[model samples]
Target: MELDDLVEELRARADSARVSQERLGSLLDAVIAVSSDLELAEVLRRIVVAACELVDATYGALGVLGPSGEELVEFVTHGITEEQRAAIGPLPRGHGLLGMVIASPRAQRVPNIGQHPDSYGFPPNHPPMTSFLGAPVRIRDQVFGNLYLTDKRSAPEFSGDDEAVLSALAAAAGVAIENARLYEHSRTQQLWGEVLGDATQALLEGAAQEVVLADVTDAVCRLARADACFVALRQGSDVVVAAASGEGDPAEAPGEVLREPRIRAAMLGPAHIEPGAEGGTRAMLPLALGESPLGVLVAEWAREEPTDHVPHLELLGRSLAVSLGAASARTDRARSELLEDRDRIARDMHDNVIQRLFATGMSLQSAAPMSTPEVRAKLDRAVDELDAAISDIRHTIFALHRVPGGRPLSAEIATVCGDAAVTLGFSPELRMTGPLADVPEDVAAELLAVVREALSNAARHAAASMVNVVVEVADDVSVVVTDDGRGLPEGVSRSGLGNLARRAEGRGGSFSVEPGDGAGTRVHWRVPLASGDGPGT
Candidate 1:
């Protein structure tokens, strides 16, 4: 017991302290590595691998719980090759011993996992293992999943130090998992903002509803990395597919999804996610503006794809609902303004133009009786023309006061021709066919303008009685006006005919004026229904 013995003891103690320090440093390094990654899947994978290496275990895994908190939705593993995983067959659900550890919410250490009373035995082709340790991973107060280690390399049992190290690693993993989720959530929110911004801008800029809906669907599909996305709006008692974008045939998605009860249920409650027929996941979110239901947004993705961003998808649906509501309000405002303007113009015509025309007609009639024979004939013609002008002004007032509703285009054209009959002294025969109700507003306006112009010209210049107006509305709309009267003079200039020709040509259509079968002039105007041009064209 001298200086030599004392120095030897000190050296042994120093060596032991150095070894403990190195082990602690290794554990710290593993913890750091686990916390570095921001991706949730990568973080979970790193945790499993680091936990296995820290505890000197031959196999390790991290099982993510499903929404029910009982089943394993995802299983990330370390120390197993792709072939080994394939051989192991499907991943283990939380059953038997795995369920026991998950339910307990604490660390579990077993010398031999096989000998445990709750063991369910491994599946076919699964590697044999002895000894087991598990720790529940918690993000805040919620248990996110569990970390598992089997077959401790240095000992038959997982020592207390190994259990402590794994528990600490699991705790660190939970924080890392939460951080990764927040990062992902923030990024998803940013993407959703961009999508909503685009939609709002499009609607504000007066983009068509169909175009806005398509843009929203495309943006959501891209964000969800989905195969297809669609917006279905409620029409009457049934839901109709409004707009869709994706890889699959759009026609296929609507029929399959609209048939699901969950989609209908979603309108009243929260969004629902279900397995799709084509080995994918389908998420349906109800789009509403306050208590009013607008439609549903459906998203489809591969079967194994992560749906953690579903909340963001719902946000997109809500944003789209708001945009739709705004667009509808804007349209209503515009229509109201138009109606108000029409009412004002109608009042002016009745109060001023019609009264003045009637007075002028009376003055001409009074002058007709006092003239000589030849002059009397000319004065009588002037009186007749003035009476016709008054009649036309009254008809214009009636048209202006008419409510703009779902009245058929054919009926409107007939009304115009009937008014023209008073001026021309005989009714024009009218015939119409095809889907006139589906005609766009601007096209209808132009068509009506052409009809009025043709009728006015016939009344003013034609010296015959019978007239025929035929309107056909199919994939293209055509209007023919024929009058049995004097044909166009050789040297006369017709500016109205030029305007009508320009109108037809601007809309990628045609207009023609030719002599009728025997006499009179035939005016033909045709325009394609799908031409993008409007009244200006």
Candidate 2:
């Protein structure tokens, strides 16, 4: 060959080498893009597609390790027909050739898998590969998945350059997969938290168990990405499904949970199961509050195991249990209070308004015969009006009965002050001090009575514009009721509080009334935060 011809051939080879370098750079760029992607499925698909392109291979598949990392599942793939996939019957539960890369957890290149003694031939009618390369996608020490590229167009061995580029791409893929998972988890946790909050609020809004529980289960499903969730309460020895949320038949999820001994034990403790005979993951956790186990919230994730969202699922699992426990306790307490309030209302109606109406009806009846037609008609009409009044009272009582009891004296006083502000056409300033959660009944009663009388006096006699009740608790708790009212009524004598003072002194506390600065009056009292240890004065 001539020197000029030889030089031209050498230059041509150099140009070809530069083109390969440029292609490798593009491949790395694609890999970086995959790592930065915010969705796991998208990242996985991108990785597979990039892999096929980088190695000049015809097809690629990405297999993410399942929940336990015991098995690799074909989670995402490229260059595969949907019909072919369906015919293959679910993503391969990685075994044989697939298991080699997973077990070794590094890049492996095979010139001809068919020639190998360890080769497991493809299933009949399955896609065949003349050349293959598998690289484990590692994020730190954890293997997220394996990327497989197969059947180069030239049917040649995978080059050393292909190994170097794919290995780097797999590392990048890790960053992307983990990044997407982090973003998705944050979004999911926030979404689930809002759901739980709304469910709690919906329960507080007061509704049937069916309605309230339905809201809770729905919220859990969306948050945890569960296939379904069922809410059940233990009724006698049996558990009844009050509400359910999920996809498909939910197997036994749609019905009362099987109370097999294994199930009962599992329910007593948290148990996460592989999903279905069909395949998936399910977890059941007891809703325990204090010593009593309330019930259970059961969740099923459709995959045999959680992929990148195990922590999110676990978070939701614990949250679901807490919500159920709290909601159930509220439900039970409300139920008990309902009965108590009904009895109280019934007694009040019998002893007060109902008896009064009955006596009034009898009086009108007695007067009926002695009167003329017009007079008898008037008396009869009075009886009818009285009967209607009785019905109105009964209705009010029924509504009030649901509340279970009058608000605690302290609560009532606070409400009265605030409610009367609007009615009295002013915004009342109210401040509370000390522990309100567990106030003593008798002390609350006496303090409220003092404040109530002061307010009533201010409205009636004092014609006062403002009232202030300051509750102070120490060794003794006190309510200082002050009013910018006209001084004590003439001839009404300040002796009205003689019994109140006795009650206060009897409890080793003090109650007194004194003139406020300028013209109003101030009544102050004290009682103990703890009782029965005070010295008698």
Candidate 3:
């Protein structure tokens, strides 16, 4: 061998050695870059970018497998603009070449993607691609997803060295991904604990129910990373949205009844997930106390992927249920105390005060005969005044003895009217006559619902300047709501009107809506008190 030839061979070997060392160093740097981020989303993105940099690929993506391991639930892409992504349409679900990698869980190198037998072709707006490389990413012995690279920048096709580097990068990515998931889970649990504790604490401290409910919705929306969060509570036979927090208006707003049948049905079931009507995912957390469903906590996300906050949401719902039970118990205890006090006061008035007034009036009558004409007239007038006072006291005693089961009917009517005032821009004229306190508990509940629905209709649909609500209980209980607004429209939809009719019919009552005396509309609901049972028997 010649001396010159030997030196030339040594220099070539040195250059090859230097290239290998640089490649190894670059691979190490890529590994470190991916591991740096603890955020699961950010970590997935970095892994894709690092893989592309290591292999000099123009486009790269990491597809996270769904639970079934047959389809991709998340696709993290790099080197693709948002506009291009929009144009690409819906994401690919493990098919053709992609499915081949998912099924085989092995490295794939395709010189021309279109020429490959398993190629399924790209969507309409996808960028041109000829070469493709893919490798499985595994956590422990289980395949988590696939790493895909295409359009190798330095060469027409990726070399064997590129494939080897990507495989190694994917392995490291699995570890980073697992670590990020753990971190996120830990953070989520911690956040959930804090939110639950705060909500429970708020209730224990005697915070108003509305204030605490609002806080819970806000926290759930933020902690669950949901697009919206709301609580629906059972009110009478219907369900109402009690609190809501998020962007735009929720499907059901506070004070509004829930109209979705599916959600209503899910209220009786355990915690579960379902697809949203338009798109995305919905987590339903049923709030129940033993067998009775108190309500449901609904959290929605704009992404189709399943949420990881289901368990947390369930726990929160249970906490809310317990609080609800406590609140109900407190209310019951307060009502019992109030009723007891009222009973005692009535007994005192009837047993002593009324008796004394009756005796005094009788004495005045007896003395009237012995006085002079002028004195007799004065004594008779005084006796008559005493009789009026005794009669008034007797009526008061009767009212004190009457009980309307749950919340008082008058208080509920006032509340409903007050809430409507916010929307109506003015308060409704409320005239409740007769013995409203003597109405059966079930009948009172139905009557209050009628008043609420009527006021709600007037506030929302009627352009009324004045509204009047009159409730009278005689032989029959009657409710008349009148609004001085534009008369009912021709061919008006009957859905809401039908609900009113159904409620009345459920109580063996009659409901009617007609034109007012001159302008606006009038609603009348009447039920026979002695005809039969009241509401929910």
Candidate 4:
């Protein structure tokens, strides 16, 4: 061979070798970028760009197979113009060349795509393509997605070298995708660990039930990336929103998500959905542990493609379920303790302080007849002791009933109001509304007690001639009482507001007092229901 031809051949080989090294470097960079960032979209974009550059192709695209392996969840293309992408339109699902990769789960190279009988000609607006290369992305037995490239830069066609590089990149992408997912999962678990710690600390601090619910909702929202985070108690036909972090009214959440139909089908297990509705995307995490469902944590997404955080979100769902079980158990215990405390305080006042005060009052009244200096002094001492006992009783009752933590509505209210009537000379006008037949014991107690307080205040302080009490049932049950007398007497201290405000403020209900036109005072109190068994649990 001539000297000139030999040097040209050596230089040509050198240039090809240099190009090969660059492709390998690009592949390594893509993998490293994926490892550094767990964001799925960014990782996917990098993967496509790297494959295309490695093969020196004009275009590259990646499509992720759906959970069912029947539909294409997403398709991302690199090096395609904005107008070109518009021409591509809504990504084709399972058809044409894309389906071949899915069905075979193997690599394929088409040097002359148009000449092949299976080419399935592209629309007129679609870009011209001559060469095509695609490889499956699989991790272990799970088929993750597909990596594809088209129209090699070489005028002739895609070389075997091009095929080899793309295949290598696909394999590398699979590993990176797996690693990124695992890293995200680990971080998510760590975050949930923090939430568990916070819940524990709040429980120890004796935080109120509402406080606990709020803390949980905030954590769930942050970790899940949901548009709305809600802690809902499962009901038959409706799931009441117990706590929420975003737009929808959890209190009024549709029952469909938590309905018996869904739960029974799901059987207290974790479930999800992208049921796109009202420009919102929703996913439900069943708050269950073992064989029971305590509640559900629902979240909405404002964007399509849940690819970003689905794996991490699943972890959040499981952790939230465990946390919910613990919270539910804590709630039950707190309520039991509250009821026991209320009863103890009520009994103490009735048996010890009330009796002592009455006895002392009697002794003082009897001694008053003597009208002697010594007797008068003794009488005065007895009266002072009696007053102290009454004050002690009042303090004990208020402290026990106004704990402001987790307690059943029915029991707490009954104890406070019933005691007031016995000690304050007025019986509350109790009313029952709604499906009282199946009302929860705790809820009933709270509502009834609210009535008792309003009545006690009206009779004892309002100086009303008559008191009317009514409880009604309907879409919403309400208890309202009216008295004909002076309204809140001037000089009434804030200490007395408990009797005035306890009903509304205590139970998440509205409490209002307005003048009854010509005669007296009217107190209104309302509480939303919490029985999750409205239709199902």
Candidate 5:
């Protein structure tokens, strides 16, 4: 041991110590950078970027494991162009070298990625890489995911120092991930409360059921960060979409039947999560009360992630179901009371007012025979006026008894035709057959509109001495209105006729106007009872 050699050794030792201190400072900076954001997605992304910078790697990625811990559910990458990614196609699924790190849960360094025996090789159009560095990120004792780096820039291959730094950064990532997740959960809960409160208040205030339901779906879509959401309610033996929100069109949903087995199963049983198109995820939550299955709430995400919020959504849907039941009961009770009050009024008008008017008319008629010729004529006219008044009262009573909300389909059709008689100078003959009560609400509504339009057209244009309206309900609903005045006129605007056709077509049905038995016009409209049924031409 010469003194000169000893001095040189000490100098080299000092340089090594300085380099270690600088690397330690860089590692601290990287940890702070990854922990700064409270957003889970941003945190995951920053962890990957920071790891790449710390190891001087040209490319980096973070692969979060799925629930089964056998595959990657999420892959966040950096240093790759969007075009390059698209060309590379589907993301890695923890195979070969990636799987080795996932299985070992320890730091790995390889001088040549392709030369390794476990290499799965790169996907087509994937950028070339020769070196790799990987580490496992753990939250407490559980391995959350794995981090991989390739093509180290500062050296031929990743050194032990680079591995040590990446391992440390991965540890800090675990803590950041746990914090971000807590924040996300808290935010989700707050949003859930907001949506529930709004829905309950709307129901309590007697908002329309459709309006409240739409609000619920919109709020849920935002809360779940979903691409689309909808609520499907059971209508008799059929399931119809009541409300929809998010990226899809809302108009296409309402009244449309849900035929998917997965959605139908959710309505009868518990919640379910299934794979979606283009690597997305779908969650179906059953909305029920006690033994009654009311509906289902479905949400879709464009990309499946490791985080799950199905339990929260299920709770929200269940609570909404209870609220809906309460609202429905309240509406029914109020309607019942109104109908009772109306019935009482109708009874009073018929019993007291009509009886008095009838008695007055009879007395006037009896007095007519006892008066002089002029006085007799005046008394007879007075009796006739009283009879007309009684007739008016009877019509009023009929209307009062048949309230708007509680009126049956048959009553509605009869009432419309009866009202049209005033304009037509004669009542249009109306005949209805089949289970009118079993028609779905939407179909019934469309049918009523068709009746009104047909009657109006007959009164205005047909100039017919006779008009007949026939409605039949079975596998489908059909409405046929005929007039005996004139056939389809030449060059007449078909806007009103077009409207009828559109309505029928919208419901998978058809409408047409043709010559009747003689010189008259026949307007025929037919629609299916349920969605997805073939057009009832």
Candidate 6:
């Protein structure tokens, strides 16, 4: 109550007030420093560091809750080295006192964290901690995360003043975090737009589908910070990697991932992220436009990596599917136009060219009968040439009328047999095996020629019914034509068979004709599925 004691008390209180003001000013500067950066990760790091310094705590961390609200998806820390982090193993999952703070969304101060009833002991190699202070960071009404400080250096425990300062820093941190997140979201949108725009422009410019797909994969991998990215297309009952970007074998990881029933189900359903091999994660996005399922897009990254961009990746996949649909439509339109042109040309040849040539041949034939011997010979030659021209025109018309898109080998064989049936009076039974529809065009063409020649011989020379044709396509392609005829005639020229054999030899294959099982003839032909040496070699 004395005047001197009163003066001393007021002076001490004034000193404390001045210190508080300085601390508040420093906190404001720290908030500005953190908010100045538009990057979400850098903002989070600065917040944690500033929080630790503001409260003079030995360790500080910011744990960002996942969408589920019970788990920490990201944990940024200050005062923990990389070695210490590795030694500490995985980050906490918002359990114990951390969960209390998250569940309550209020500031908490504890003298000894280990003595708390809900305390979950630290993991192996974690540093000792006794005092604890935590405050929830909220963006608007939603709790974004919690700022935690432990082991105050200057006091036995965190006082009310320390809690108040931490709470203020956490509030400022919330605003900074929201701003950084918005900036990051905008940056991500811009990046995705550039990627999709580039891919769309490339496709519209007539780039090959493979090249466009590669560019897309590359862009996605870079954006996601992924170790690899790949697109798998449905092939028969399975999926195969169509495009890939990164190191290691792209097919190996994606092939395994595609086999999972969950991932397979997602190919026609929704996009999802799942754990992958070797401590990694995979984000799968179905590449589809409406009801048409194109395939799936897969991106792989380390398990610890952030997956905030998964939704963007799915969006990219949808954009790519649209591009694919557009490209396919363009190709179909071009094919239809080419088919129409071919049909028009065939009609003209049949309706006009053939008739004119026929008239010319007839005139030449009539003149041959009325001319002298030398002149008659010349007229006969002219008539023969005109007749040959007419025959060639008719064959050209038949080719034009054949189905476009290169009919399947089985279908082409059936047509050849049907035409031969008109001459032989019976249809040949046909059998095929081993991916005949996937045969290369050049190889298929040669096989078709061989089949036609064999069938022609059967109709003209065999002179019997019950013909059988078997076509097998494996690593090697082979065809067998058999007929229940009297057998090879004696003293046959063999020149036609010689030509067929030479055709096979030129392509590293073989052709042979011999007597059939009982009273018929068998023509055997074989060729390598890919051009190279003969089978034995």
- TM-score of every prediction relative to native: 0.68, 0.58, 0.63, 0.58, 0.68, 0.71
Candidate 6 deviant stretches above 4 angstroms = 1-17, 87-100, 110-132, 151-159, 193-206, 214-230, 235-239, 244-322, 348-361, 370-404, 413-438, 446-505, 508-537
Worst 10 residues of 6 by lDDT: 248-257
Q: Considering TM-score, which of the candidate structures 2 and 5 is the better prediction for this target?
A: 5
What overall lDDT goes with each candidate model?
0.82, 0.69, 0.84, 0.68, 0.84, 0.81
Per-residue alpha-carbon lDDT of model 4 for 45-156, expressed as tens digits? Answer: 8888878777778989899988889668899888878898898777768677878888898888887788876767786578888888989987767889998788988656
Residues 1-537 of candidate 3 have per-residue lDDT tens digits of 699999999999999899889889999999999999899999999999999999999999999999899999889999999999999999999998899999999999999999999999999999999899999999999899999999999899999999999999999999999999999999988988888788777776677777888889999778777888888899878989888898625556888888788778778998999987478888888889999998898888887454567878889989889988887777678779878999999999989998999899789889988999899888877765665565456545545644645556777778778978998999999999898777776666567667766776677567899999999989899999999998666643445456557767877889998889888889999988754653432
Clash count for each candidate, listed in order shown: 0, 11, 0, 15, 0, 0
Q: TM-score: which candidate is best?
A: 6
TM-score-best of 4 and 5:
5
User: Best to worst by TM-score, what's the order?
Assistant: 6, 1, 5, 3, 4, 2
Q: How close is candidate 4 to the true structure, as a TM-score?
A: 0.58
Could you give me the TM-score of model 5 versus the true structure?
A: 0.68
Which 10 consecutive positions of candidate 5 have the poorest summed lDDT? 528-537
Q: After superposition, how far is residue 512 of candidate 5 from its true place, in Å?
A: 29
Residue 168 of model 1, lDDT score = 85
lDDT of 5 by residue, 1-537 (tens): 599999999999999999899888888998999899999999999999999988899999999998888899889999998999999999999999999998899999999999999999998999999999999999999899999999999889999999989999999999999999999889878888888988988897899888898998888777678888889999877889999888754442877887777777889888778887688888878889987999998888888441467877878888899998999888889889988898899899988998988888788888888899999878876765665465446445555555445768898889889988998899999999999988775667667767776776677678899999999988989999999988656744455567668778877788898888867889898987674443222
RMSD in order of candidates? 7.2, 19.0, 15.5, 10.4, 11.3, 6.1
Worst 10 residues of 3 by lDDT: 491-500
Candidate 2: worst 10 consecutive residues by lDDT?
Answer: 395-404
